[model samples]
Target: MPSLSQFSRCLFFILLSMIVTQCADKSVEENLADGIKFTEDRQYLRALDAFQQAVAKEPGNPKAHYSLGGIYNLMNRLPEAEQEFKIALKIDPTYVDAIYSLGFTYELMGDKEKAQPYYDKYNKLKQKWNEVLQKESETR
Candidate 1:
């Protein structure tokens, strides 16, 4: 037999699971788009909600992680932003934008040592991407 607190905890988890399941019903892209729109509208809380849903729906999606990180960064949630950006890099190591943003997050948090490697990676990737674009344009 469960005690009152035990039962309450169980009930809470059940409700939370149900909510998460319902949120997962939406596609990751839909959530990401909603997050972007909400951010553009300056609705930070709504944007956070959408990005969180995107992350829950697609845990391995780098874009979802990046979007979530961006929202956290905008809201001055530095630790959460760092975590999400790191997750994005874990999912896609060559995610130059996330690398750049992670560096920026660290800089904002006053950790220049931690920011250096990410900034270096971002700069390298940006240069390579630019070269590719330039070559493509030359061929066109």
Candidate 2:
């Protein structure tokens, strides 16, 4: 019951929305890889962008937020790093890296006392993480 011009406009809007959504559907893995690659290359800003995209894609992915926090920490954006690390921990309580980063963030914030518990947890986890890595390396 619509006019030709009206129908064309509706179709155009629908097509545009579909195209935008498809473009936005990129996998979180792709974004994470891009982020890591950029981080390795020392392109911190680009890495941050990629990690942000990954977080956008997988809002529940603690690792994505942790990676972003790591990048920010490296860049000396302590507050931003702290925020992202906190968010990552909120999403995943047992995330060792986030806990470690938060300890560092507390240090940066001049709250050594707040950092203590996190530091203890990180040290415990780091030992285990290192052992796992060593075993994996021996296997390789």
Candidate 3:
């Protein structure tokens, strides 16, 4: 049997881990929001830091990747923007914004041919989304 001290230590560590995880989740959201605000203010470096933090905390989050990509695009860092947008799309293929942004990035990089397909995909997805919204409105 574990000693009382050992049991207490184990329980304390478990509780600490739970608290850390909860805080990390909230931090990621806060970082993402802060990044957006910074971007709106045109503080690209600060926005980059905040978005990078969010991405680090939540590597699988498409929104974080998208936001980071947007900052890169604004800074004219086309390659980085392309990469982040691609990662976002890979995480969520139906992310319309990422799809559009990737195409825009490609266009900015002077690759209209590569951009065309993504633009097409974005348009099709938008049309489908609008149709769904229209049907929902009709039902209502």
- What are the candidates' C-alpha RMSDs? 7.2, 4.9, 7.0
Q: Which tens-of-lDDT digit does each residue in 74-124 have in candidate 3?
A: 999999999999999999999999999999999999999999999999999
Better of 1 and 2 by lDDT: 1
lDDT of 2 at 39: 92
Deviation from native of the Cα of residue 43 in model 2, angstroms: 1.1
lDDT of model 1, residue 40? 100
For candidate 1, the per-residue lDDT at 52 reads 95
Candidate 2 structure, TM-score to reference: 0.70
TM-score of each: 0.79, 0.70, 0.81
TM-score of 1: 0.79
- Runs off by more than 4 Å, candidate 2: 1-25, 125-140
- lDDT (Cα, 0-100) at 87 in candidate 3: 99
Q: For each of the candidates, give the backbone clash count.
A: 0, 0, 0
Candidate 1 per-residue lDDT over residues 14-99, each given as its tens digit: 99999988776888899999999999999999999999988887899999999999999999999999999999999999999999
Error of 3 at 67 (Å): 0.5
Show where candidate 1 strays beyond 4 Å.
1-25
Best candidate per lDDT, number?
3
